[model samples]
Target: MRVIFAGGGTGGHLYPALAVAEELSSRDPGFEALFVGTSRGIESRVVPASGYGLELISSRGARGKGAAGKAVTGAMLAAGTFQAMGIIRRFKPDLVFGSGGYASVAAVCAGWLMRKTVVLQEQNSVPGLANRTLAPMARRLYLGFEKARGYFRRGAPVVVTGNPLRGAIKPGPDRDARKDFGLSGDGPVLLVFGGSQGAMTLSRAAAGYLLRRTDVQAII
Candidate 1:
């Protein structure tokens, strides 16, 4: 089966789709997958490395933008939809899966307009604007949090699937893991990460907190 996975700007919006695609490929050796995202997103780097094809579209976040910026974003989204439609036509995917992000908006809409089966996966308790807008077009909605169900339209085919995790992730011995990182005598090791596209605010906060604690070892 061929599938088009759309979404990416950060790891939060991208990784789940990758995890699902990876699982599908493993389960079915003949499974084919293509990723749709913006060139600026982390997917540009990660997708190819994961051995999947990626198609880039013109898109950007409309939220927190000024009127002029929002207008420009809208124009980009319209263009992106057209670009996605072209990709969908050429790829002829059996299914189009959308993970919430600005990049998914165009691909999902294009797929729905083309009368293709569309599915969505939302990884946050509060749904994003793209997912909320496209929820009506989806045949199924998979959510990371059960509380997110209330945000979509009533009677929507919502399923609480939690978040898709990569197969490579598994529990390992804490001491061994710490040793691998060259950390010894751990007085509670703190690991701080801001997803694929790092968040400056989160990094700053972590930095401030770590500065006050000498007993804590961190992997940033």
Candidate 2:
């Protein structure tokens, strides 16, 4: 079956969505999955690298310097609804899965309007606005935290799947990856990753502190 994943403001949404994709892949290698997110969201980068096709749309959350700004953004989102419908028609997916993003609202709504199955995966302790609005209309809801359920509207069946994560993300020894980065293997080693997808400042601090130690060897 074909599936589309929507929602991606942060790693909170993108990461969980990817994890679910990975799980489906493990279970059925032939399942096709596509991801939909704003052109600027982290998913544009992470999803492709993970071997998933990504469809882009112009969408931004409601924000403004004042009420006027929110009003204009709301107008854009309204237009985006039709744009999302076009995507659904072209994709012809059996199911649409929403992760979390303003872009997703349009896409999921269009899918629901078409009577295609729509599933929501809530990643935060509190369900975000897009999911909240779509919950009543979706066919199924999956949440990272059960506590988030009380926040959704009635109608959809809810399931607690925890946060879906790609199997490629593993916390373990870096002996293999280290060899590729061109570093000596004599001292204490630390892997530092920071960007939109992680806690860069904390990793930087920890690596810096470790490097200063007389016993330690390196940081990545």
Q: TM per model?
A: 0.85, 0.74
Q: Per-residue lDDT for 38-150 in model 1, tens only?
A: 99999999999999999999999886558888889889999999999999999999999999898899999999999999999999888888999999999999999999999
Residue-level lDDT of model 2, residues 1-220, one tens digit each, is 7888888867777888888888887888678988888877788888899899988776788785798988887777767667777877888898998887676887787788888898888887788888888887787889899899788755459888788667766776667656766766666565565554347777768767985787765544
Q: What TM-score does prediction 1 earn?
A: 0.85
Least well predicted 10-residue stretch by lDDT in candidate 2: 189-198
Task: After superposing candidate 1 on the true structure, give the runs of residues whose Cα lies further than 4 Å from its correct spot.
Answer: 63-66, 182-192, 195-220
- Name the candidate that leads on lDDT: 1
Largest TM-score belongs to which candidate? 1
lDDT of 2 at 167: 71
Question: What residue pairs clash in candidate 2, if any at all?
Answer: 6-99, 7-100, 19-165, 19-166, 188-217
Each candidate: RMSD to true structure?
A: 2.9, 4.8
